[model samples]
Target: MINSVLMLLIASALSSSALAKSCPEVLDSTQRKLNAVEQVNLCDEFQGKVLLVVNTASQCGFTGQFEQLEQLHKKYQDQGFAVVGFPSNDFNQDRGSEEKTAKVCYLDFGVTFPMMARSSIKGAKANPVFTEIARQSGVVPRWNFYKYVIDREGNVVGTFASSTSPVSQDITSVIENNL
Candidate 1:
C-alpha cells in the first residue's frame, strides 16, 4: 500500500511538471534584443499580459507610428499590456545595421518597450513567434508596422494593417476589453 501511494505521488509530480512546461505555441521562443546580447523568452517574459506585436522598419513611411506605439505601451503597461516591436527588413526599409536600428528605436523614438533584433517577419524564414502568430491569426504582415494583438492567454485576438493607428479606437477597444 505504501509503494502504491509513493508511485501515485510520483505520477502526480510528473504531471504537474509537464503542465508547467506547456507554454503557448505563439510565445514559446526566445528572441535577442536589437543591438544587445540579451535575449528574452516571450512566454516567460510576457505571458499573461496583453501584447501588441509589431513588425517595424526604421525607414518606412509609417515609422512615425513608434511614438504612438510608445504612448500605448506606457498607458497600458501598468494594466498588464505591452507593445513588443520586432525590427524586420522583410520590406527592405529597415536601417541596415543594428546600431542604426537601435538608434531609430531608442534614441529617435524614445521607445522603452522591448525591441527585438532584426529578423524576417514574413515568408519562409519568419521567426518562430511571428510564424506562430500568422498561423493563429490567419494574417501575415504585408508591410512594416503590421500589428498583432495577443490576449493574456497568448491567443492572437486581432490583426491590424500598416495603416491602422496603434492608439486607434479599434486597437484600444480590443486592448481594454481584454484587460
Candidate 2:
C-alpha cells in the first residue's frame, strides 16, 4: 500500500509539471516592456484570451491607429480579449530609443495596452512571437501596425494589414467570435 501511494504521488507531481509545460513553446516566452522593467510571460498571463498582436512604430503614418486599438481593447477587454503592441524599428520609423518609444506610445498616444520592447518583426531576425504569427497567418508584416488576430487557443485566425482600420467590422467580428 505504501509503495502504491508513493507511485501515485510521483505520477501526480509529474502530471502537474507536464500540464504546466503544455502551453505552446512559441507562446510561452517572456516579453519585456519598451521602457519599463516590467515583463509579460505570454502563456502564463494571456493563455485563454483572444490576442490582437500589432507591430508598431512611433513615426509611422498609421500611428494614429493606436487610439483605435486602445478603443478596441477597452471594448472587448472585459470579455477575455487583449491587444498587445510590439514596438519595432524594422522600418526605421521608431524613435530609435526605448525611452522615446515609451514616450510616444504611452504619453503621446495615451496607449494603455501592453507594449513590448523593440523587436524585429520581419525576416529572419523577427521575434519568436512574430515568427509564429507569420507562420500561422502566412503573412509577414508589410509595414508598421500590421495586426495578427489570435484566438483563445493561440492560433492565428487572421492577419490584418496596416490599411485595415482597428474598428473595422471584420476585426471585431473575429474577436467576438473567438470570445
Candidate 3:
C-alpha cells in the first residue's frame, strides 16, 4: 500500500508540472496583489479572458477613470472580460503605500477589478508584462491611466492614450468586437 501511494504521489506531481507548462509563455508571469503580499500567476488566472490593462495612479488627474473602469468590469465580466489595474509610482503621483492606494481605489472609487501592486510602468524599469505590452502594441504608456486592450488569445489589440475615457465608444467598441 505504501509503494502504491508513493507512485500515485509521483504521478500527481508530474501531472501538475505538465499542466502548468501548458500555459503560454506570453501570459506566464506572477504579479503581486494590491496589498503587496499575495502573488498570482497571470496565465493561470487570466489566460482565456479578454483584458483591459491600465497603469493607474491614485493622485493623478485620470484617477476618476477608475469608476468607469469598474463599470466596464461589471458589464463585461460575465462575457469573459476583465479589467486589470496596475498601480504605478513612476509618475510620482501614487499614494506611496499599498494601504493608501487601496483606500483610493477600493474605498473611494469602488474598484472591484484586480489591482496589482505599485510598480514602475515606463522605460527600462517597467515590469515584463508592460514591456511585452509595449512591444506588441507599439505604444508605451505616456502617463498614468494609459490603457492596453488585450484579446482572449493574449494579443495586445489596442492601446488607448491617457485622454481616452474608459467608457468611450472607441474603447468599448473594440472590447465588444473582440468579445
TM-score of each: 0.91, 0.88, 0.86
- Candidate 2 similarity to native, TM-score: 0.88
The better-scoring model by TM-score among 1 and 3 is 1
| lDDT of residue 127 for candidate 3 | 85
Residue 91 in candidate 1, Cα distance off native in Å: 0.5
What number of backbone clashes does candidate 1 have, counting pairs of residues 3 or more apart or in separate chains? 0
Candidate of highest lDDT:
1
How does residue 72 of candidate 1 score in lDDT?
A: 99
TM-score of 1: 0.91
What's the CA error at residue 104 for candidate 1, in Å?
0.8
Top model number, TM-score: 1
Candidate 1 wrongly placed segments (more than 4 Å) = 1-21
- lDDT value, residue 75 of candidate 1: 98
Window of ten residues with lowest summed lDDT in model 3:
19-28
What is the per-residue lDDT of model 3 for residues 1-179, given as tens digits with 9 covering 90 to 100? 99999999999999998875576544768999998689989998898889999999999999999999999999999999999999998888996678999999999999999999888887888888898888887888889999988998788988899999999999999999999
lDDT of 1 by residue, 1-179 (tens): 99999999999999998886678888989999999999898888998899999999999999999999999999999999999999999989995799999998999999999999999988889999899998998899999999999998789999999999999999999999999
- Name the better of 2 and 3 by lDDT: 3
Residue pairs of candidate 2 with colliding backbone atoms: none
